[model samples]
Target: MKNLLVILFSQALVNNFMLARILGTCPFIGVSQQVETATGMSLAVVFVMTMASAISWLVQHLILNPLNMGYLQTVAFILVIAALVQLIEMLLKKNSPGLYKALGIYLPLITTNCAVLGVAIVNIGAGYSFVESAVSGAAGGLGWGLAIIVFAAIRERQQLAPIPKAMQGFPLALVTTGLLAMAFLGFSGFNVAKFVGM
Candidate 1:
């Protein structure tokens, strides 16, 4: 239990997919203009990532390894992720047309979000068990959501603050993101395994 908690925290903070690993920057920057949109995108990513990790883990162990088709891991993972994004898109379109429209291209872009694939690959590379992969996926997603939402909040606030002409818009955002990433780097020294008595 302690180990699981440590894994969750490590993924969500110490090794965040967005702020730490820097996997899914497109959506992190493009869809983070508003907190509501960021929240929705985060939820979608969380759902898809968790499901993808579990399914990919199963496929890796049950089919790929047995068939000696490890080379197909990337293609197989992309297929699974793309399918999951489509399903989420349909559900969102049916239930929340507003959010669907707000998300626009970024919603579909989740299919290609490197963070999703990165987590799946990381799970496999780390030799994590089924439950560990799922937890890591969920934690990674949460980390992404947390970073984007916080960034959005900061950007929202920045709207009111006076800024130099040269640092307006994307320039300012990039600087802020860099600073935030540096801040997150502080967690690198944390040792989750030792904390959890591993």
Candidate 2:
């Protein structure tokens, strides 16, 4: 249990997909204009990442490794991720039209999001068990969402703050992201593996 908590915290903070791994930047910038949209995207990402990690783990252990087909890992993982994104898209379209529309192209673009694929590949590389992979995937998504939402809040306020014309838009957001990433770097010295007894 302590190990699981450590994994979750490590992924969600110390090794955030956004601040640390630097994945899924497209939607991080696109859908993060509003907190509501960011929340919805984050929930969807958490669900998909968790499920994809589990399924990919099963496929790797059960099929790929057994048949000596390890070379197909990337293709196999992307296929799984693409299918999951499509499924989520349909479900969202039917259950929540407003969110579906708000998400727009970004929802479908999740198929290519490096964070999703990165989690699946990282799970396999780390040799994490099924439960750990799921936890890590969800945590990574949570971290990505946390970073984007917080950055969105900052941008929201920045809209009103009198700022230099040169750094009004993307330039300012980029600088803020760099600073936030540096702040997250402070967690690097805290050894998650030591706490988890790994």
Candidate 3:
């Protein structure tokens, strides 16, 4: 339980997806002009990451590890994530038209989100248990969601504020990301392994 808490906090705040990991910068800059869009993207990313991690974990432990086929790990995991995202997109379209509309084409882009793949690879590298992997995956998603939402909020507000012509849009968003990354550096001392007696 304590270890779980540590992983959650570490991923969600100490090492955020955007602020710390620097993953998924495309959407972070391209579609984050609005809070609603940011939130929708975040949720889609969360679902993808969680499912990808779980599926990847199962593949690694049950199929890859047993068959000694670790070389195909990346290919297998990516395939699974892609298929899962498609399924999710279909489910959302069928069950919740409003959410599907809000998500729009972003659901398909989840396949390319490095953050989702990062979580799956990280789980394997960290040698996390099933529960730990799930926790970390969710935490990664939460961290991503929080970072994008915060960034979107800031950028939205910044639109009305004065700014140099040269430092607008992409440039300004990059600067914001760099500063946020520096802030997250303050949590580097947090150690989940130590706290959990690993």
- Measured by lDDT, the strongest candidate is 1
| Displacement of the residue 31 alpha carbon in candidate 1, Å | 0.7
Task: Tell me the tens digit of each residue's lDDT in model 3 across 1-198.
Answer: 888888898988888877888887876776688898888788878888888888899999999999999999999988988998899888888987877787666778788888888899999999999889988999999999988888889899999999999998889988988887787788788776787776
TM-score of each: 0.97, 0.94, 0.90
lDDT of 2 by residue, 22-61 (tens): 9998888888778888888988898889999999999999
> Which residue window of length 10 is worst by lDDT in model 1?
1-10
TM-score, candidate 1, is: 0.97
RMSD per candidate (Å) reads 1.1, 1.5, 2.2
Candidate with better lDDT, 1 vs 3? 1
Every candidate's lDDT = 0.94, 0.90, 0.86
Error of 3 at 152 (Å): 0.5
What does candidate 1's lDDT look like per residue over 95-193, in tens digits?
Answer: 999999999999999999999999999999999999999999999999988999999999999989999999998899899999999988998998888
